[model samples]
Target: MIDVLPPWPLLGAFLLASLLLAVTPGPAVVYLLTRTLAQGRRAGLASVVGVALGNLGNAVGAAIGLAALFAVSSLAFTVVKYAGAAYLVYLGVQALRSAQAVPQQQAQTPPATMKTVFRDGFLVALLNPKTALFFAAFLPQFTSAAHSPLLQSATLGAVFVAVAATTDVFYVLMASLVAGRVRRMGRARLWGRYATAGAFIGLGAYTALSGSRGKA
Candidate 1:
């Protein structure tokens, strides 16, 4: 609600910070680019939607105190973090297997269904406990003490997600252009599959190993 928002100057600062954070190359950006280059624009766009939705969920979760739960309970954080990492590894393995199963002549066949792609993206983003923690930590900095903290947090989270989604869509469009060129080369197509798989697997490892006390 407008009443919960911080002053215009504070809101402007928050928007500026959100834009910078959204554009920074991070796990989400890598995921988007890999999906676009490997699967196509449709999958990439689906992934963007899925991720955006997942992020929105985290924002809501933060507003409702889920982040505090994770912050206090190491077990909860570890369980969720490992689960997410495992899922990423599973996706990577699936990509490799799918690539092998498809014959060279069938390369034109779609790598995965849009539903599957969307689900993968959603789960990947949702499972990252750090994302929830990030929202919990980040949104409070711009909140006004005189207003409802919960509403302000949720509103700012929504705004941040919107900015991130816009940047993600741009990344997809750029990656799609490169993918068009890669499609013309059979070897490049095969390599693209491997690269996608590697990216996912590597991200999984990174997530699993990263410190628990930090922003996503």
Candidate 2:
């Protein structure tokens, strides 16, 4: 992939941008926070694992040329985009409903089993086509056909996933800690739960409405 390598300055800039994008407040971060706050550290870690798997899957898809297929096909692109949009809206409504219910409920519940947690996290990531698009677009600026496109994309994707995973794990652990403390008090717990729900809804809306997109 060295043949198509961008100039060092451009490559460094792309990598930096990818790191920033990974940390920005978005569906993944919001989900991590909400899960951590609601379920605790173990469940939150499970979710993070699943999300990491999803990111790996996206990277693999990009490496293998599946992402290019979507990029070239407008119909396919629309289908994937709308599917992601629909899922986001569904998640938003669920969060809003849960927020409405949490105030009336008095006790916090135990988290799900690791299996169920993993399944939920996996499904959420698997269904999100936007992640693949991100890989497709983000990697190319650092690569070209002159290089081994697959390797370059894979390398960039792997770096991004590594940085992002580390950042998300930190979020998960911190959120879990704060949430555990907050849950001891009733009103604080209620507000925390509400805030988590609102974050989800806001992320969903942003994902659905935002026009800025990486090439698929």
Which candidate should be chosen as best, given TM-score against the real structure? 1
TM-score of each: 0.96, 0.76
lDDT of 1 by residue, 1-216 (tens): 667777899999999999998999888888889999887899999999999999999899999999999999999999999999999999889888877887877788667889988998898889989989999999999997888888989999999999999999999999998888887898778777888889999989988998855667
Off by over 4 Å in 2: 1-15, 89-106, 144-147, 190-194, 212-216
Per lDDT, the best of the predicted structures is 1
Cα lDDT of model 2 overall?
A: 0.72
| Superposition TM-score, candidate 1 onto the true structure | 0.96
Candidate 2: residue 100 Cα off by (Å): 6.2
RMSD of 1: 1.2
lDDT of 2 by residue, 50-139 (tens): 888878888888778867777777677667666655665665576556556654464464445788767656656755667887788778
Supply candidate 1's per-residue lDDT for 103.
Answer: 80
* Candidate 1, pairs of clashing residues: none
